[model samples]
Target: MMKAKQRIIILLLAGLLVLTAASCSSQKAADPATETLKLGVLSLEDILPMVVANEKGYFAEEGLTVELIPFQSTVESQSAIQSGDIDGMMNDMVVAALLKESGTDLKVTSVTLEATDERRRFAIVVSPDSDIKTVADLKGRELGISFNSIIEYTTDEMLVAAGVSPEEVNKTAIPKIPVRLEMLINNNIEAANLPDPLITFAEFNGCKTIIDDRGRSIS
Candidate 1:
């Protein structure tokens, strides 16, 4: 079995390969008449650059027409890409891998964000009143996550890093981040992994953080 860090690196490299190949293929097949490219985005701070570029008419300045398509979650964005509704989206390396494995012609051309000790972006959290204070306490408990996506991948890795086997925890698919956050706040699940903005929001509202991707990088 691959070590946790190795697995993360391999997955990211695979994403880069898929992304580079897709970009080349698309460029070769591009039509000058249709200059518009539709890209999917979520309501996360990580997508702020694209938003600013669009709002500031950067694409227009380059004689390019770019459409910023908004989706409620990564799962929705992936569906849009798979169905040809959108050409691509800003997503995690893990999501890129999952898309490719499911036969979606996609690529990850950039690393917009990286988790670090000084800039933690994702975390495993619990209700403020829950007694699950440590990673080991998560054993045999159900973790709310969007299954098969980046959230699940990070949660597993963080658990392993904390000396807890991933097999010891159960993952429940709660597709929407808002719904997952709500459930977590209501104590409907023992724990949940969330990304920033929501992670910050949850902490402010009294959720206790168990562990985070501090000092870690997905790529």
Candidate 2:
């Protein structure tokens, strides 16, 4: 019985050794330098260059088969990276900064957009007949903005520029641009801040732009 037990122990040790060797071999075979790199990306139209680079075989030329995974939001993409479901992602500075702040070992290898572009402006609009004429008038009024978005940042900047502190305004998070536009039109909210497509659409449908980067900033 002792001999049989010794033999079983030897077999288990041998199996562990074999498994270790197989794992080493598998890792060597799964070299990122030669294997596909999975990239998680947010569903933004600005990622056209990355899409083009992959479709045009630019990554393949560098011995990389980039598997592009599109997520609906940056938060979703960041979660993918944190969970090791993806190798890397194309994210904004603020998003990456937030990840770093939360103790995630994420790094930014490139800058996708200008650090400060004059064209990157977020528009603040009010209903044509709304009493609010300027950012100053937004005090105590409900302003709709998309949370964790560029529009939110620009809106804050606009408010600060107009001497209206965040404490003076009641900013609400409404994620959908269409919903924000509809609210602005139906006079449900005092004003809404969003990107050009919605801003243009709203202005076209009777919402007036109260604060826009006429010539100062990029959108």
Best by lDDT: 1
**Candidate 1 per-residue C-alpha lDDT over 127-189 given as tens digits, one digit per residue, 9 for 90 to 100:** 767889899999988889887777888888899899999989988889888889998888778
lDDT of each: 0.75, 0.65
Candidate 2 worst ten-residue window by lDDT: 15-24
Q: What is the per-residue lDDT of model 2 for residues 98-172, given as tens digits with 9 covering 90 to 100?
A: 667777675555544332344533578998669888888889999998667565677777887778897798999
The TM-score values for the models, in the order shown, are 0.80, 0.63
Kindly report which residue stretches of model 2 are placed more than 4 angstroms away from their true locations once superposed.
1-35, 115-118, 125-132, 146-151, 175-190, 195-208, 212-219
Please report the candidate that would top TM-score against the real structure. Answer: 1
